[model samples]
Target: MIEEQGIIIALDGEFAEVRTQRRSACGGCVANGACGTSLIERLFGRRVTQLRALNEVRAGVGERVLVGISEAGLLSAALAVYLVPILGLVLGALVGTWMNGLLLNRSLDGSMADLPSVIGGLIGFLLALLWLRGYSAGSSKRPEHQVVILQRLH
Candidate 1:
């Protein structure tokens, strides 16, 4: 499980909104003085992210707590969001290129070598986005996707 510590700022039924600072790698790295990350961090200090976590600890406002989500759930979500689109794009482009060759009986050196690929890529990206939207809507109701408050801080 990936755990984070935050302070509860608001409560709504079974959920609590916790505010936590988003940390960057520059803070603990030796390249802090020469890295571009340090420059970016200076421009945008430490931004806080507000997350809604399931209130399993029955915590109240202004209270610190630890919340976590499962690693398997995180990995699956990441794959769905990142890999699906790329795979779709590659497969669609291949299909388009193959179709072009099969139809024209010519190599991809033609004048419209890229049109089919472009159209196929766009269609694949759109389809992947639509599938992602539906998947997220269905997964939101699953407990594995939620970060639940596990411990209340002093």
Candidate 2:
């Protein structure tokens, strides 16, 4: 499980809204000066993340708590969020190129020969986004995807 300390800012029934400051692993890394993430952090600064967690401990507002989510759950969510769209884009571009080869005998110079590729890529990306929206809606209700309050902190 991945755990973090946060303060409960509000409560709603069995859930609590916890606010935690985003921490960077790059903070102590030697490559921090050259890393893109570190540069973005330097530009925008550290951000505070607000998340609704299962208040199984019945923690109240103003209380500090340890929140956790399973590592498997986090990994699956990341894979779904990143990999699916990239696959769609690659597949769509390949399909588009194939179609172009079949439909046009010769590649036209400065013409719309690549139009199919652009259109196909856009279609695939939109389809992936639509699927993700549905997946997120269903996953949001799953216990595995939920972050839970493990214990109240002193």
Return the top candidate by lDDT.
2
RMSD of each: 2.3, 2.4
Candidate no. 1 TM-score:
0.83
Instruction: Give per-residue CA lDDT, model 1, range 65-140, as digits (tens).
Output: 9888899888889999999999888878877778777887876666767987777887888888899999888877
**Using TM-score as the measure, which candidate wins?**
2
Note the Cα lDDT for every prediction shown: 0.86, 0.88
Model 2, position 152: C-alpha lDDT score = 95
Give residue 68's error in model 2 in angstroms: 1.0
> With candidate 1 superimposed using the best TM-score fit, by how many Å does residue 49's alpha carbon deviate from the native?
1.7
Worst 10-residue lDDT window for candidate 2 reads 105-114
